[model samples]
Target: MSALGLKIIDESVQQANIWINEVDYRVGLVNKQRAYRLLRAVLHALRDQLTPDTAAHLSAQLPIFVRGIFYEGYNPSSMPAAIRDKDDFIARVVAIFGPEPPEDITGAIGGVFDVLDARLSPGEMAQLRGQMARDIRALFAD
Candidate 1:
């Protein structure tokens, strides 16, 4: 049990750590904080590109803490943004970096997608991928 005596909070933190670690490994980054920032940036970019209901469905499968991160500063009313093609999507992720962007932006995005693929169900992943353009969908591929 955690200090707060909440098993759910403890478990959610554990799960979030597992995800951030996986992202770090996938992105080949030693710094977990960088992995976390990369994860958050990609998630926000992806969420803005998804339909509100689709975004909700995807969020349901996320760890409680990660889901909170995913939805941070989200505005559903203006969502499913006009992000077309891979370049545009990558631009959105890069825009979140605010200077000092990752060396391999596509790899960073794909690293987060890989973590999502490993954590989320195939059905939900398919639904999420269906919302993206074909070029962007390539990042989710094995």
Candidate 2:
């Protein structure tokens, strides 16, 4: 289970890294509209890889990212609470990906989660990290 979890995490990280690189490259060359479109495309691609339940949850959350990219001078605080939303996202990912996450990728999964959680408040972020760790342990228990 640990091995599988690692694999899933690794694959997710690789995909995310590639997506970020692509977004950076596109942002350098495109207008705001085009850059946002590229970000949407990346989100869509990532969404496709998620389980239906996880995808639905994330789909609802994705508008946050879109608004950040498209709206001028948008404050993150003005948007809906990311801390609350991110907990759900992390939970969904753990639930959906736990059963069949690839082997040898646990570190990658941990890394991606670490990076995503960095945006949260310290207390809320620690709670999410603890939840993820617990979830991983639960996955390996059986």
Per-candidate Cα lDDT values, in order, are 0.89, 0.38
Output the TM-score of candidate 1. 0.95
Q: lDDT per residue, candidate 1, 3-106, as tens digits?
A: 66998998999999999999999889888888888889899999999889999999999999999999999999998899999999999998985677689888
Q: Please, what are the lDDT tens digits per residue for candidate 2 over residues 66-116? A: 423323232333333222333343444444444433232333334433433
Clashing pairs in 2: 3-103, 4-102, 6-105, 6-106, 7-102, 7-105, 9-109
* Clash count, one per candidate: 0, 7
Worst 10 residues of 1 by lDDT: 93-102
Stretches > 4 Å off in candidate 1: none
